[model samples]
Structure formats: C-alpha cells, structure tokens
Target: MNKAILIGRLTRDIDLKYTQGGMAIGRFTLAINRKMTREKKQEAERNNQPTADFIGCIAFGKTAETLSNYVGKGNQIGIEGHIQTGSYENKEGQRVYTTDVIVDGFTFIDSKNKNGGDSEVQDESYDGFYPTDNDDIPF
Candidate 1:
C-alpha cells in the first residue's frame, strides 16, 4: 500500500530517455506548496525559506512518451504513484541515496491558455496499469 497522490506544477520539462533495451523513461520534478498557518507563514517569510517542496518523479513506457510530448515547465498535473528509494556509489566514492515517485497515472490540471481565460482545450490523462490478460486494449 505504498500509493501516493500528488497535484503540483512541473519544475521543468520532462527528461525523456530510453534504456538499452528500448524502454522509455521520463524524469521530472514537481513543486508542491506547503500548507501553513499565518504564524508559520510569517516565520518562513522571515527566514527567507521557500514554502514548497520539490519532488522527483519518473514515468515509464507510453506514459513517459505522452508526458514528454505534451507537458512542460510550469504545467500543473495530478499524478498517482508509488514511492521508490534506492542508493548507489558515486564516482567520488560517496554513497548517494535517491527517492522518486514511480508514476502509474497522471492528468493535466491546467488549461492551454496561460491567461486563465476560458478555452476549448480538453484535459488529457494517461494510465499505465493494464490487466494481465490485456483483452480490453485494442492494440
């Protein structure tokens, strides 16, 4: 039950790449604001600290391709996924640990227009999970 749901803006464009075996992988950062009381807000302001957390995330296969093609920096989106953590030795002989959300589903949350006016742009979403039988998918 390691599910996580997040709604935030993309810190930068999706980094799409492929493995040697031709599997697609996309990496992106999400900036999520922190909920705070007035006192906490004032304290944060005084400390000159940001009130948002930047989270690293990744998507695979068709989901990665779709995201890389359609989304960019500052676009808001909702994603449902699971947290993954790992560690490795770096070239400097230091142990580096990492955490990321492995996205299973995502949906665009912002309109195409930056002016916030009404537009005809429809929402786009993608889900990565599929049934074991794969009977429902046409392709």
Candidate 2:
C-alpha cells in the first residue's frame, strides 16, 4: 500500500497549469509540524518548538481546478494519496530524483470564512465527485 494521509497548511497558493491536451494540473507544498516532548524539565524548556516537514503534492484534472480556485497559502486541508518518484536530468546534466504525492482525494477541513460557516464557493463541475443533496443522507 503506497497510500499517504496528510493534514497540513499550504505553503503557498497552488500553481496551476494546463497540459498540451488541456488537462489542468495544480501543484503545491504542505507544511506539517512535528511536536516533540522532552523528558527532562531543563531539556524541555530549552527545546519547546515544533518542527515542520514540507511535502510536495500534485492534483490533476478537475481536481486541479477546484484546488486552484478554493485553496490558498496557509489554508488547512486533508489529503489522501499515493507516493510517486521520478528522476530527471538538470541543466548541468545531473540527475535529480523527486518524490511527491499524487493526490487522489482532498477535503476542506478549515473554512475560509471568518464566521465559521461553510465556504460559499462551489465548483459545480468538479469531475463529478462532489456530493449533491439528493445523493445521500444528511448527517
């Protein structure tokens, strides 16, 4: 199982682009914090900070457009995906390997609204994955 689940803040606004065949793609990085607790009081006092890990992710197709329109820097989100690794030659002819998550599912965990209501924004044509009132039970 190559699956990964992450909940983090976006480092910046998504960079959106289209492929030659007009498939939309959005790329972004997520900053996740790791909190450490020290056993010793003196040591804990000296190291009371949270470390962050930045992860690269990519969303394609209608998902990409939805992400681009709805998300921005510092927005909190939950992602479910799989890891992908690839290598490419740089301008200096040095090969670089990159590992990134290919997003398969995403959920808005934090509302952009200041009043704590759902974000009024909606993408009606988001690859048909969004739920409709008639589709299921309300919980």
What local distance difference test score does each model get? 0.88, 0.86
Tens-place lDDT digits, model 1, residues 24-80 = 999999999899998998899899988889999999999999999887888889999
Task: Show pairs that collide, candidate 2.
Answer: none
| TM-score of predicted structure 1 | 0.78
Query: Which segments of model 1 are wrong by more than 4 Å?
Result: 112-139
Compare the candidates by lDDT and give the number of the best one: 1
